[model samples]
Structures are given as C-alpha cells and as structure tokens.
Target chain A: MSAPEASVAVRQRRGSFGRLFVSELQLVFGRRRNQVGLVVLLGLVTMLGVALKVSQLRHPGARGGDIISAVAGNGIFLGFAGLTIEIALFLPLAVSVLAGDAIAGEANLGTLRYLLTSPVSRVRLLAVKACALGVGSLVGALVVALGGVLVGTALFGAGPLITLSGSRIGIGDGLLRLLLAVLYVTVGLAALGMIGLFVSTLTEQPIAATVATAMVSTLLWILDAVPQLDWLHPWLLVDRWSAFIDLLRDPIFTDRMVTGLWVDLAYGVVFFGAAWLRFRNKNITS
Target chain B: MTATRGAAGRRTLWLVAAGALAAAGITGLMARGAVADPTLPPLTPAELLAKVAAADVDGMSATFEQRSDLGLPTLPTSSLPDGEDLSSAIALLTGNHTVRVWVAAPDKAKVALVDGSTESAAIRNGNEVWLWSSEKQQAKHATLDPSAKPTPTATPMSPSEAITKFLDEIEPTTEVTTSGSGYVAGRAVYQLVLTPKDDASLVAQVRVSVDAQTFVPLGARVIADDGTDAISVAATSVDFTRPSDDVFAFAPPPGVEVTEMTKDSAPSGTEKPKGDAKEPTVHGTGWTAVAISPASTEKPDKELTTILESLPEVSGSWGHGRLLSTALVTAVVTDDGRVAIGAVTPERIYAALAER
Candidate 1:
C-alpha cells in the first residue's frame, strides 16, 4: 500500500479503538446487574445515614467528639462513615460483580469470539475492558458516597466536620477530604477489580469468576484480621482498606494512604499484566 | 502454532516468577525493619524470669505514653454522669494520653494525665490523697486511715506497678523466653516474652522490656493470640532522681470546688464501687485465673447491647452467655447476672464459674 493509504489506515485504527473504549464503558454500565449493585449500595448508605441520625438524636449527650459522632452533627461526614462501613465487604462485592463479569460474562454468553474477530488488537481490547472495569468500580464507589451526602444532608444538614484529632474543618475542606477518601477507596477497589479481571480470564463461568474474586477479597480480609499473620499484613490487598481514615485527621496523614496506593498500584500491575499475558496467547474457542 | 503457544506459556511462567520474587523481596525488607537488635545474648527462660522477678527501681519519675488498639466494641458511657472523669483504665485504653508518674518509694507517688490544655492529677502524699481535674476545676480530698489498709486508687497503673502485677501472676503454665534486645527511651533493654500454655487463652504473649542495667521494666506489651498488640505501655522519658516532695503534695486552689471524703464517706466521683463489693473474686491461679464478680447494677445501654449481640454466644454447665474474646482478654457475662473476665478462654471462664 502507498504511504498516504497506510497513514489513513492508522488513523482509522486509532479512531476505532476510541470508539471501542466508549462502547465498552457503555456495555459495562448498561448491565442490569451492575446497576442493581449500585442501587443496593446506595440503599445501604441511606440506611446507615438514617441509623446514625436516629442514634444521635436518641443520645444527645454522647461523650467525645470522635469522627463517628462527628457524622451525626454534619452530613459531610456521612460519606466517610458510609465508606468506612462498606469498604469491608459491600464495596468490593459491587466492584467484583462488574470486574468478574467483564471478561468471563462475555465468554459465557459466547460473544467473546465475535469480539476477538474484529480488527481490534488483543492488547487494546483487554486494556479497554480493564479501563471499563476500573471506571465501573469508581462509579460504584461514587454512588455510595453521593447517596450518603444527599441522604446525610437531608437528615443531619451540612456543617463543619469535626475530625478524629478533634480539629474542625469547614464544609468545603471537608467535602474535599471526602472526595479524596472516595478516590482512595476507588483505587483500592480498582486493584481488586484487576484481580477479578484476572480471575475472569481464567474461567468461562461468570458466576465462578465473581465468586473467586469475592473469595480472594474475603481471604485477604481474614488474613488482615489475624494478628498472628502480621507477616502478611503489608502485602494483603485489603490491609489498608481503613487507611482512608487518615484523611479525616487534622493534618491528613498520607503515609498509610500513600502506602496503600502503592500496594494497590503494585497489585494492579502484576494481576493485570498476568491477565494480559494469559489472554493474549489463549486460543479463543468460545 | 504449537511453538507460539509454548513461547507464550514460557513468558507467563517468567512473569509469575518475577512477581513472586518481587513480593518475597518486599516482605523480607519489611520483616527486617520490624526487628531491632537480633544478635543480643540469649537468656534462658529461668534466668529471664529471675531477672524480671528481681527487677526493681526506686525514686524514679517517668513520662510515658500508652496506646491501646484492642479492637474492642464500643460500650455506652451513659451510666457515667456528666462532668465525671473517665476511669483510668477506660481513658488509657481509649486514646493517647501523656502520663507523668513520680514514684518516691514506700507510699509517695503521683500520676498526672496531661490533656491538650488541662491536666488531671492523683497525688498520694503520706496519709493525704488528692485528686484534681483542671478541666472541671474540682479537687477531691481523702484522708487515709492509719489503721485501715491503704486502698487502691482508680488512677492508671504505673509502669512499675503494672510490671509487678504481671510478675506476681507468673505460673508454671507460662512459657517464658527472651525475645531479644531493643532500646526503650534511649536505654538498652532485654525483651522478655511470656506465653500462656492454655490453648483457650487469647493471650499469645506478654512482652516486658527490662532495663539491662537497672532491671526496671521500661515497657510492657500484651500481645493477643492473633498477634495484635492489645495494650502497650512504654516510658518515653525517665529520670532516676526522686521528684521533690512538693510534687506529691496538693492544696486545692481557692476557686476550685473541693469535696472532702472522710473515712466513713464514700469516695467522691470515683467510678470504682466502694467497699468489698467491688473486689473481684479470683478463681484458680496463674495463667488460668478467672476473676468472677457480681454484675454491675448499671444496665447495658443501647450501644453496649448492640455490641453484646454481635459477640458469639457460649453455653456450658455454668450457663449461657455471650463471650467477647480478644487476643488477650475474654469476658463472659452469664445469664445469672454474674460476670467472669480473664485472660483465659470462655471455657476456662465457665469452668471457673462452675467451681464457684
């Protein structure tokens, strides 16, 4: 082919990849299951906000101005409290549902083969799927947080946030911290999403992939809970799930949060790399 | 096609190998950083125990910080009236507190907890004891009876007193060993580890750091069976010189509210129950000692009930109750309104209750 035609082909390829990325995002988010997961998460955050408001009202004279009670006085803190309650299990489960289904669900439905037959490179295809899963996980986290903010503001109203360190922060700064907390939690869940994506690539059964991903997350949580397993704490994926608590501190402790980010980054690289290598070479029989 | 697949498999294998190597290296680095001095001379279990038992320091004052991460469920504090200070144990376990303790031997000692801007102090000077809270601007005066035994104060335990209590409870069921050496407050110390032999006990080990030269316990940590530090106390700074007598003497400021407790009067504002009714009845001895007591008259509040409901229930010949088990402590409140708390297991607690 001539040089001009080759350049045109390259432009067409880049354009097609962009289209694929957008289409992949829509496909993942358009799923009923993923939507239901977000709704359920929102429901949980609402329940938590209501419970906290009721508890605060019932006991007006609670001692100590700790962060948990700070939520009762200010709606902005509800986002932090909601994230704290859900990061343990529900958030991961929601992310897993999307991530675990990203690849395996396509294969289960027998559409993976058709997708592979397209002019798309296998690497680009996997990258798009991973990005879509990452976006899905972030949205899942935001749904809970935004839901918390709305419900909390309706019940408790917004005010200056009283930090765990006993310092008060204005509503604007408190919301900024809340945003950082949400991003931090999303990054952690995205790492788990990569693990789920890797697990999904190994099996044709979407349910099995989801279950495997959740089992892995649960195992990490169990390891974190065991004090005798201190050797494994630094390496466990969920070990720093609570590190977001540091964001609520007065000076904002970023040491643990930074370490958690690094841990999540490492997990994402290794697991996603493994998934790519495996999927790149696997025979697409489906 | 076959050769291409073979190459792909080889690449995947190498990728996994590299990942494992990186993980192991990181873990190794972390493990190395956690230990202090690993090459110290090893003391035999018997020698270590003897050293600990003989450990004593006099006329010393230390400023210490304590942190407790027991992972305990929150309990309601509604039973405690407003303006009443938290019990020392609760305050110590709940948050960070800087405590200055002065021990001048025989009967003179003082402990002051410094809050951000306020200070609460308990001073025992000869027969006169004074409790002062700057936040409340109140002071309580109690005169000790010369004939009656000295009553234990509700103040947080001094590091020396805590070490003495731990040493007194040593039994054959304890597996004692020297963990190695470390520095506490810039002083070289030997770490002595004591592990309970009881399988049901949540206490994995109790580590006591002894000052190598003075044999003073500079630090002590209670490690639960799960490996988490349930309670840790360390002297951040120490001065061997005796604090002046003025440190132990207290005269309330003119504007502060003063409540004087005579010998017959009940202890004012102190959460501890007065008289023998509050004393826990010890059952068994050593590592398996279970302290049984009548349940508190204060009802469990909403929050405490929720926490109790979350705990697993255990039933035995002694009756049914919920058990709160941590790494080093197990507490059981039975259906009969009796409470048994110990470092032993729920079964052991039940067994002790049955013996009663």
Candidate 2:
C-alpha cells in the first residue's frame, strides 16, 4: 500500500478505538443495574445527611470534633461525612459492580468471540473497558459528593465554612477543597477498580468476579483496622481512604493524601498490568 | 498456529518476569531510602545535656508527630456523651497525633493539635492566652498577671518539652550515655540515651536527639522493658526562621463562642471542693516513684467506674484493689479510692500501696 493509504488505514483504526471507548462508557452507564447502583449511592449520601441533621437537632448542645459533628454547623460537612462513611463499603461495592463486569460480562454473554473477530486488538478492548470503569468510579464518587452537598445545603444552609484548624474560610475556598476531595476519592476507587478488572479477566462468571473484587477491598479495610497489623496498613489499598479529611485543615495536611495518591497509582499500574497480561492470553471459548 | 501459540507463551513469561523485576526494583529502591546514620562531632552525655541547657532558639515553626503504644485496652467511649473529649484525652496516652507549632520565643507561641477532622489550638500572645476548639466552635481567653514569669502550660507536644521532664530525673537514677549521632527532622543531631538504673522501672530507656549546632531537642523516644516503643515524639519537618507576626495575632472568628475567663478563676465544675481534696503523696524517687492520690469524695462517672471494674482484681497486704499493668506503667487502684501509678512493675506499685 502507498504511504497515504497506510496512514489513512491507521487513522481509521484510531477513530474506531475512540468510538469503542465511547460505546464502552454507554454500555457501562446504560445498564439498569449500574444505574441502580449509582442511585443507591446517592440515596446513602442523602440518608447520611438527614441522619446527621436529625442528630444535631436532637442533641442541641452536644459537641464532638468529628466530620459527623461538624455537619450541623456547615452544610458542606455533609459531603465530607457522607464520603467518609460510604468509602468503606458502598463506594467500593459500586465500583466493583462495574469493574467486575467489564470483560467477564461480555464474555459471559458470548459477545467476546464476535468482538475478537472484529478489527480491534484485545489490548485495545481491555483499555476501553478500563477507561469506562475509570469513568464509572468518578461518577460514583460524584454521586455521593454532589448528593450530600445538595441535600446538606437544603437542610443546614450554606455559609462561611469552618476549617479543622478552628479558622473560617469563604464558601468558594471550601468548594474548591471539596472538589479536590472528590478527585482524591475518585483515584482511590479507580485503584480498587483496577483490582476488580484483573479479577474480571480471571473468571467468566461476572457474579464471581464482583464478589471476589468486593472481598479484596473489604480485606484491605479489615487489615487497615487491626492495630496489631499496623505494619501492613501502609501497604493496604484502603489505608488512606479517609485521608481526604486532611483537606479540611487550614494549612491542609497533604502528607497522607499525597502518599495515598502514590499508593493508588502503584496499585493501578500493577493490577492493570496483570489484567492486560491475563486478558491478552486467555482463550474466549465461551 | 502452534508457532504463534509458542510466541504468546514466551511473551507471557517475559512479561511476568518484567513485572517481578519491576516490583523487586521498587522494593529495593525504597529499602535503600532508609537514611543512614549521620556523622557529627562526638560529645559526652554531660556535655550534650549542658549544651541543651544553654541552647537558645529565638523563633521557629514546625510540624511534629507523636505516637504512643502504651498497650492499654481501648476505652469504652461508644456509650459516653462526652465521648469525643474522653477519647481524645485517652488518645493522648495512646495512638498517634500530628501537631503544628509556631514559637516566637518570649511569650508568643501556638500549638495546633490536628486530629482526623478537627483541631484544638492553644495560642499564647504576650499576657493573653487562648484555647480554641474547632469542633465545639468555642474559644476561651484568659489574661495572665504581667509580672508573672512567661511559663506556658506544660504540654508534651514538642520533643524539647516532652524530654525536659525526663531530663529532670538525670541524677543517680538515670544512666546517661551518648549512643551515637544521627539525623532527625533533616537536621544532624546527637542521640542522648537515658537508661533507668532500676530494674523495677518499666521504661527500658529514653532516647533524645538534640540538634548538633543549636542543641535543641528534635526527637525523643521512650522504650519499654518489653522492647516496644512506649512513646515516640519527633519533628517531621522544621524551619528555624521566625514565623510571621500575623500568626501570633488572634481575633475570635465570627461564629465561634467566646468565653472570657477572669484571673485565677478555674472553669466551673472543674475545680474540686477545696477542703476534701487531699494532695497526692509520692512514695519513692526518680523512675520508680509512685504518686498516690487519696480517694475522691465526688462520685466517679459511670464510664470511669466501668473502666476501673474491668481491671484485674488483686489482693495482698495492701488490701484488695484492681491492677492495671501496661508495658511502660503500672497502676493500683484500691477499693477505698486511693490510686497509685508509676513507670514500675506491678509488684512495686502494690508494695508502694501497702507501705502507704
């Protein structure tokens, strides 16, 4: 083939992968179960906001220096409190649903053979699925954050925000920090999603993949909580899940948060690499 | 097909090998990053102590971390109304904390204890002192006598302040020696090891790292006899330059509750009824000393009572009491209400109570 024709063919393949990624995202979000999972996440956030508001009302003068107690004073705290509660269970559960289904669901439905027969490379398909799961994780975190912020503002009303440093900040700065927190949480969930993606490649049963992914994350959390196993906490994926609380401080402690991001990146690399290797060689007999 | 299959298998093996190599490389890199001991001019224990005494630092700002592994049971705070404060007070004796401090020397200092989602700060500017809690949205201010010496409350927030208490017991009880030189908070420092001469003492040793040039203490650790860290406080980062003046200035934030306290007036409910309160009596000296506070007339809280009841019961010539023994400290609480505590063995505490 001539140079122009060869270049045109390469461009066409690039465009096809772009379309593949878009379709993958649509496939992830359009499913009824995935949509329900997101709504459930939002519902949990709303419930947290209402519970905090009710407790604040019941105990008028009660004082505690936690995110839950801070919710009464600032509507902004609802987002913080909700994310803190949900990250341990609901957030990981939601991400697992999408990530565990990424490849396994397609293979289980017997569409894997058809997709392989198409012009797309196996690695490209895996990348598209991973990207969709990344977006899914981001959406899951946003559901909790935005849901909590809206419901909290409606209940407590927005005003000058108080930082953990006993100092006050304007609403604009508070919202900015909230945005950073959302992104930080997104990275953590995405790291867990990578682990789920690898598990999905290991099994043709999406249910098994989902359960295994959820178990891995839960195990990390369990390891993080045991004081005797503290030496292992730094290596656990869930160790810094709550480090987002540092963003609420006046000077903003970034030591743990930055380490958390690095930990997430490392997990992403290792697990995604494992997923690619597994999927690249697996025979799609189903 | 067979040829391609063989190639794919080879590729898989190569990739796995690469992954393993990468993991090993990263682990090796991190292992190498453990800092080596920094060399400094050698000094004897007495010279180092004198240097710390004469050292003067005008102003600085720093962040520090304190960790205590006292091997105490988790306090039952779930059912308590003042659970946050109760747990926070207990957390000071156990677990880990990060603190930010700013000192402008003569009468201007601020220490912010940063916990999970809240901060409590104590700021002293000239004759005025402020205690603020972000969680409660409250600030308490008190004006001190201008003529009184500028002695802030004794807070073990810094390595210098925390180590000073142990340094006071440097007489015959502590075997002082210079272990070596090293680095703390990125500054070259000398390690002064204080080993308790008494075998009954639960403390194995106390190690303080003093800044080589300035002689200011930058880190300290208390090792228990069981080879565990009882308490470790260190400056994670530091800056010796004077902090900005605005950091010392304080005006209560708009929404916070401001309470002005009069001179010499303790907060209501905190002051014990004067005549009934007996001063704590000390039995022994230095590391093995035990302080016994007489039985209180006031009723102990239900939570405190529950905690006390959970301790192991012990009876001897001292009479029956609950004994709480940790790696670094032992406490004996008699049924009649006397409590004896010291960094000594349980038998020593029991013996002290019997003598009393």
Candidate 3:
C-alpha cells in the first residue's frame, strides 16, 4: 500500500511528459557541437552528389559493362550505395558526438546538480535523455538520407534505385530502402547512445564522453574486421551492424537483418541496464 | 565451484543468445518458404541439351527484353540476352519442348554495334552468323555439347554466348511445375516460375513462358532486388534450321580501319556513351543495316549538339540504347547470327535522323 501511494505521488510530481520532452529536445539540439555534426553531415552528402554528377558526365564509355550504369539507367543503383559510401564507419562517430556527451556535458556544466536537487528521479532523467537523443539521431539520419536522395535524383535523374547485388529495384523500392537504411543505422547506433549517456553520467566534460564512446565503438569495428580472429566476429558491436548492406539487395533478406536488429537492441538493453544500476543510488554533488 | 558457476552462467547466456538469433532467422526462412526447391531432382547435362535442341522453332517472334544491372553481365546472367536461358531450357526439358543454339565463330565475320546505350551492349560480332552483345563484358566461348564444359577459347560466358549458358543453369534451378501457363513466340508455351531455394538470392521470382507443348521458353521476366521487373525477353523469331559455319566467322571488309584491339585502349564510356570516346570509335552504317527502330528514344542519350559541333572531327560512332537492346534481342532470337533491320517504325526513323 505504501509503495503504490509513493509511486502515484512521484508520478504526479514530475508534471506532464510533454513539458519534459520539450525541455529535453532543447537541451540536446540547442548546442554548438550538434550544429557542427549537422554541418559536417550536410557537406559530406553534398560532395557525394557532386561526385556522382561529375563522374557520369566525364565518363560515358566507362559505363558499358558497368553493372552500376545498367541498373542506374533502368533506374535502380543510385540511392543505396550513395548513402552507404557517404556515411558508414562514420555514422557511429556522429552518434557518439551527440549521445556520448549528453550526461557528462551536463555534469561538467554543473547543471547536473540542479536536476538532482529537483524532485527528478534518476530513472526519469535517464529515460528522458535517451528518448531525446533517439529523436535527435533519427532527425540526423533522415536529413542525411533525404539530402543524398534529393541530390542523387536531381543530378542523376529520378531513376529506379539499383543495388550492388544483381537486381533492379524501382523508385518506390528506393524510398523503402532509404527508410530501412536510416532506421537500421539509427538503431545500430543505439548502443553508442547508451555508452555516451553512461560516460556522460561519470564525466564532467562532454568531450571526454564523446571521445570515449567513439574510441570504443571504432575499436570494436577494427577488431571485427580482423579476419584471423574469426571467433570474435559475432560478439563485437560492429559485427552485428554490418547487416546494413542487406537492405540494399534486390529481394529483401530479412532473416539476417532481423537478427542483427535484435542484437543491437540487446546491446542497448545491457548498456541501459548498467546505467540504471549505476546512477540509481549514486549521489550527485557536482 | 563458485568460479566455475560464474563461467557457466556466462557461457549459458552466450549460448542462448547465439542459438536464439540463428533459430529465429532460420525459422523466418522456413515460415516464408514459399519458393520451391525446384531442382529437387537435378538433371545431368546431356538430358537438358537434347530437350532444348528438338524444341520447335518457326515464325515465333517476341520483343525480347534483356536488362543487366550493369551494362556488363555477371554469373548465369552473363550468357542470356537477359536471365532467360535457364528458365527457357528448364521449360524445354520438363515442359516438353526443345530450343536450338547455333554457336558463332569469331573469325570470318564483320559485326558492329548498331545502338549506343552507355552501359547495355549489342555487337554484331559475326555477320548474320553469330551476334554478341552483352550488358557487360564477360569471357564467353562455345562448347560442342552441353556437358562438354567451356574451354578458355570457346567459353560461352560473354553476353553473346548467353543463349547457351542460359540453358545450362536452367537444368539446375528448374523442376516441372504445373503452375502458370501461357504461349510465347507462336509456340504452345507453359509459364513455369523457377524458385531458387537460395533464400539470400536477389532473384525473388522468375516468370517464364515456355511453349506449352514444345517446352521451349519463349519469354521470361527477371525480377531484381527492389521488386522491380528489370528484364522481359521474349523469342521474336526462332529458326531451327542449321546455319552455315561461316555465320560465326567474321572478316572486316577491305580498307576498313581494323583496330586490332590494342593492349591499351582508351577507357570506354563511364557507362560510357560512344560519342564521348577519347579514342577513334566504330561507326554503325558500314557493316550491315537498316534502322531497326528509326525511333531515337530507344537509343542512348548523347549530347548530339556536342557531337554535331564536333562532326567530321568526332572520333567515334553514335547509337541509341534501345537499338543496342534491340540488336541484342534480335541476335539471340534469330540465332542466324545475322540481324539486319528487319522492321522499321516511324518514330525510330525520326530519332535516327536527329542523331545523324
């Protein structure tokens, strides 16, 4: 009876969830570094678009016997590869920049104490921050993908989206591919988000959290690429994330894809579970 | 015991996780196991060929459409005008039909590419003898029999040699299915969709129309990864009569610029358009001809203004993509290795005039 009443009382005290999310959004995107990542992402996608345009113009003969051209003319090859090349091995880094710094940046600014001093429970704060970060990541991924597609279509013509694999997918299929790529990449980066969030909780400076997350994620990727250590392939975070290519194949293969998504989700769970356990009972005087 | 327990716990968690992921994936494949493993009873090479050879061939004509992801060919796709050789051959076998292949010789022939598609290819390799046009360049040579295996000199791996190779993969991926039925090229064609059991493959489905009685596949549609229908090739005309051996041979006419494909040829089109070639290129009119389409839209979209301005000074030839695709289709369909402009449409004539 006492537990129920305490829970009801705590829930009532936090005010509306809407007000909380609004504040969280402001805190996440309302920073200079987020703007920097955004600018970098835009510039990168723009470069990819320009490159595709110039290459097509410069080398017409180079197209024959080229599978990319055949598929592109029939309207299938542009969007999938263009997006992947523009920002893979690079996505996790951007994610780390924003998420890795979330909590640590707050703690460093000495504003963390304000939250602890308020009636906010540790779990509520972690939940709100994660949700906000997820939204931000979603926005970032969509912007890059949309920018790539828009530019690719404008310059290359809105042909069908061809795959590296030997299949010619149409235009509608291209949009679906774009959505899948964005969603999977965003989910694949969730572990980084949690790692960044956790590191943020421990450190005062956001840069430390950001760097730590990028270092760990990238190191795991490098480890995954080492073929000799065959046994370690499945365990590392990067191993599971490699399924991003599956989305581009002609007939969608969901078996490996779904499995990868779940593994990513598991990583997020473990990270959040650890964060919850660590910060739930800790004191914050900073 | 306590240390052992901790290790065991970790091991169990790992085991369970791995097992769960694998099982989930396999289960999905099993649940969505709509594609039949058609090759349940695989046939040997000889049986597949005899079945195809004796199939009926007459005035059956189809608007054969062959699409390659790249202008170049890959895998079994390397040999067929599109991805039909396998399905057509399979239909010939179990569906009760036969299709004949008349291999072309490289020498004693003068063939040229009539169309100008950047990536797709169409080559008149041997006069009316043997025609070679590929979406891509793959090494293709001919073999004496289906089971004889391709030798380095006569491998049928190139797009021109696709007709033979297409029949080869068919016996492996096909099963006698009593599914959809249809007619193609004036032959009683039975449409059997071959379901390749490899779940990871991009070929989601293949819809082939085989002569219902003859079992010769007259038409087929190759669906790509994006669920878009990429290629639709149909047999426009099939002549079962044996052609002269000289059909495959090619010899350039007198005073012709026979560029002995140098060790270092300038890079072709970047999916290259023929008009933009850095080196001297081939022109279409010299070899054989009639405007197949006369309609320009079927051809490559080159900057004619640039070519026109450079006219008399331009190094290479010009053609359209549609013409390339058509020349390729005609070569495969007629099998005489000799495809001249059989028919001409008015739209194509206008397009041709503009290009000229």
Candidate 4:
C-alpha cells in the first residue's frame, strides 16, 4: 500500500478502537445513575479537605500516635472517611458496572453477532473490549483520587497528607502518597473489572452480569468483615482492599502489601482468564 | 520552617484540641486564684520544641493515657514522637482511639496497642514494643527504635517527688468546679472540669478530693481531650528507693529476626525521624527507678498524705505496703521544691527521712 493508503488503514483501525472505547465510557459516565456516584466521590474529597482544615484550625496539637492508634483500633481515619471508606468498599461495584456490561451488553444488544461475523475473532474482540473497559475505569479511579487530593489540599492548606498515625508529608509528598494510594486502589478496583468481564461472558443479559458481579463483590466484603472467619480471610478479594491503608503509615508498612498485591493479582488472573475463556466459547447464534 | 517532636507535637495536639481556655469554677485542676487563664495562647512551632526540652522528671511515675482520633497512628500517651508530620497529620482526622497507659517513671510503661480488630499492648523496652492479640495468648514483639545508651551517672529523685516535679513543670492552667458528686476506683469523688492552657502538660486532671478521706486526683478527669484515659494506679507500695541497677536494660528473646528495626521498616516509607526535634523530656538509659505507690488504692485519698499522715493509722493505702526507705536515697527535690529520696527495695537498708 502507498503511504497515504497505509496511513489511512492505520487511521481506520485506530478510529474503530477509539469508537469502541468511547462507547464503553459513555455507557458508564453517560448514565445518570453513575453521575450520582461521581458527585458523591467529589463531595467526599471536598468535604474531607474542609474537615481537615477545620480540625487544624481548631486543634493543631494532635499527634500522629494518637491518630494511628485510633485508625488501627477503630478503623476510623481522617478526611472524607465516609467516602474513602466507601470507595474502598464500593469501587469494585463501579468497575463491575463497566466490565460486567462488556460482552453481555453487546450480546444483549444483538451487536455481538454482527461483530463476531466480521473478520475479527471473538476472543480478540473480547480482549480488546476488556482492555478498553479496564483503562476507562482506571482513569475514572484516578479522577476520583485527584478530586480527593485537590479538595483535601485546598481546605487543609496542603500542609501534608496527614495519616492516622499523625505522620505527614508536605503538599508535594502528600500528593505523591495519594497517587500511590490511588494506584493501589485502582489495581484493586481493576480486579472488579475482571469479575465484571467474567459475568459478562457467562450471562447473555447485561443486567444479570452487572448484578452477579455486584453480588460477588458484596459477598466478598461481608466475608471480610465478619470476624472469626479466619479460614476464609486470606481468600476474600475484599480483604485486599485494606492494603491501601498501609500506604498511610509513616514508613508505609508493607508486610501485608506483598501479600495483598499478590492476592489481588491472583483474583484478576483467575476471573479475567475465565472471562476470556467464556467469551471464546460464546456462541453467536444464541 | 520548624519541626516539633512528634510525641511532643501530639501532646501539643491534645492541648490545642482541648481548646483548653480555663473557664470558671475549675479548681484543684488549676490553682485556686484566677490565674488569668494561665496565658492560653497559641504556641508557635518553636515554643513547642523548647517546652519539650524543658520537661523535668525527678523520679517520674504514673500510668499514662494514650489516645488518637484517627488522623494519626499509635503514639505514646504522654510523650509523642518527634517527627515533623505529627501535628498536621493528626489535625485532619477524627480518630476515636483511646488507650490506658501505665508508666513507672524513668522507664516502665505499658501501652495498650490498638489493632483495628482488638487493641492490645503490653510492656515496651527500648525498641521492642510487645503487643498481644485478643484471640491469641502468645505475645508478639516488634522493634521500633534502638534503645539509647544508658545515661552516665545521673541525678537522684523520688518517684512521687519526681511526679510532683513533673507536675511543677506543667502547672495546671485549666480548672473545674462542680456540684455533682461521684466516685473513682471506689473513692468518694467530686468532679471538676479542667481545660488545659498548655495541653501537653496535663496527664489528667489532678483531682483533689473535697473530703479529706478521698484522694481522687482532686476532681481531675482521668482522661485526655481525646477521651483516652490512663490506667489508674494509687501508690500501693510507696517507696522512695531506687530500683536495682538492671531495671532499665532490655534483653530480647532469641531466634527472632531482630532486623535491628521492626521488620516493617523500609516498607514504612516512614521518612527517617527527620531532623532531631527537641524533645520535652529526654530520658537516658541510666538506672532511674522509684518505689511505686500502692499498686491499687481502691478509694481515692482526700489529700496527699505524707509519712506523717501517710502512717496507716491516718491513711489506708500508704501505710501497708513497704517501708519508706530514705537513705539509699538520692535526695531529689520535686517541682514543688519538696525534698524526696530514692530508696532501695523493702529488703536493703536505708536512712528513713520522715516527710518534712
């Protein structure tokens, strides 16, 4: 092919992928229901900033030890705890919303048959769709993280990202920590994508896929919270959600980090692979 | 451009959060006369460090209370860390974490570890802080900081006297006058609302009983502003003697990988305890020990009865324990300028100095 022809072909391929990804993004953020969650997170970050600033204006002598002790003992932390904790609790659901709709949404819409009939293979198409969803969700997660930091800094004077242990990092450092924490949270959230993708492949109905993935995440959270279930503690995907907390430590204690990351990765692999397999076997005639 | 001790910062945090502007009717917690709210002014970063370095403990002794509202992590109840981030970090969060503290001057303190699920903390020696899990009986030891070298031949002081001395350093700024009546550890007690002018100076309200029969910390609150309370211990065995030489040293168990630091070190990303911020009280490794008051004096004492009134006939708890040895005594004056002696155990011999 001549240069223009080749460039045109490349442009066409890129355009097709971009269109597919945009559609996925629109499906999630484009919905009115998802906007509620988005606003909620935004409010959480802003309020967290306000709360922290108020505390400083009121009582600046507090210590890190006091904060750390409180967090460890009570699972209470500073800043939009309601929202941060919520994010920790529900980010998975958000990921599932997008991922779970992947193949199933297409199938339910009757577009899966048309796409499968093209020159593209079903497995490749599913992989591409999954990738697009994961990236989109990851970007959303970053947005949420940025929202928290921005508001937290504005209200708290960007002094430092204070932790439950009373340790702090200056504004620059705080941002860095927030970034790291968000990244970890993102990875954790991504696992939801894998599950969502799996459900999407298993069910031909988008609603069923979304509901199943959400139920799975909720069950994991319940299992993690119901103490005395030592036997099941290590395996629950939600248990890893707390790994981000380690990032708050002065030194960022990580004996659990390694384990948590591994656990999350394992979940992603199993669910993602299962989804890929299911999609490969998905019959278009049905 | 200033750094305050983390521990000190925490105490300061308590003081600030206390919003401890002395209101009316508060007494015992503060001196009787109106003390002009004791200069309840906002402290700068510099003043905080100076105050930490200035803390003096003759022969200190008291069970401390450690509390943190979730903006920060676990820290000493009375003494906070000397890190830069401490104040700002804690100021941003609402942590409902309280711990009961027990400190036996110059050295022994038990911190109740708070571990989200169930809090537990045992003895802490130098860098090795011990914590027990509620579900498990076996204790786990983690290294924090390396034990500092023992202080060279140091000054002598009495336990109670040292405590009083500590009291001198932190003259009460807040006061509480109350009509309500109550009891603590079985003693008839009057309540007082104490707001601190200098937050870190308050361990708890020094409640003095209205009735001569009760020594209920003079209507003081046993808790800090954070709602963290100290483990109450009345001088069950009041002795003015120094403990044997080996009391302050630490000898760890074998086979444990003493990573020189807690295994969680590098991962902590915990910035190295940045610049050496001046600490309020710098305790050296030199042997500093004091005969503790009765382990438990069920009822509060109306007043601090000395050896004269400390006699069993006059007081219940002060008389029974061990002999008040004065000679092995290190004549240490308390913050109030009252003379105190550190004595050996109930076993060894010493000159007995009856309270002046």
- Interface RMSD after interface superposition, each candidate: 10.2, 3.5, 12.2, 23.5
* Candidate 1 lDDT, B1-356, residue by residue in tens: 88977986786788777777756655653343244554556776556656666666668888676767776654444443332345544655654556778889768998876544345678889888888765565678888877886677687786556655655566467877787688777677788888888777777888988777777788898888777888888877777887777667576744356899775665654445444367779987777788998756666666556767888888888888888876567899876667899987777888888886
State which candidate, 1 or 4, has the greater DockQ: 1
Model 1 C-alpha lDDT per residue in residues A1-286, reported as the tens digit of each score:
9999999999998898899899888888788887788889999989988888788778875633344555666787778878888988999888778876788989989899998877788878988888887788788778878888889899989987655433457888888888888899989999999999999899989899999998899999998887566556878989887778777643454545776887887788789888897788778778
> Which rank order by TM-score, best down to worst?
2, 1, 3, 4
Candidate with maximal TM-score: 2
Q: Can you tell me which runs of candidate 3 are displaced by over 4 Å?
A: A1-15, A64-79, B1-356
Candidate 3 chain B minimal-lDDT segment of 10 residues: B329-338
The TM-score obtained by model 1 is: 0.55
Error of 1 at B66 (Å): 8.7
Better of 1 and 2 by TM-score: 2
Please tell me which predicted candidate would have the highest DockQ against the true structure.
2
- Fraction of native contacts under 8 Å reproduced by each candidate: 0.05, 0.46, 0.12, 0.00
Error of model 1, residue A255, in angstroms: 4.4
lDDT of 3 by residue, A1-286 (tens): 5999989876776564556668878866788878777777766766766765577678754555332344234323444444455434566777877775567776777787786665665667878878877887777777777766676666666764444323346778778877887788778777668777777667677788788888888788788767455346556666656465566533343444566676666667667655665676567767
Candidate 2 lDDT by residue in tens digits, B1-356: 99977987887777677666656654543343247787677887766877887788878888888989898876654654453555556667778888889998778999998866678888899888888887677889988788876578666245454455556657578888897677777788899898999999999999998988888888899999999989999887788888877777777776578999885565533655455557899999989999999876666678778888888999999899899999988998888888899999998988888896
TM-score of candidate 4 relative to the true fold: 0.43
| Native-to-model Cα distance after best TM-score fit, residue B289 in candidate 1, in Å | 18
TM-score of each: 0.55, 0.84, 0.46, 0.43
lDDT of 4 at B286: 17
C-alpha displacement of B309 in model 1, angstroms? 24
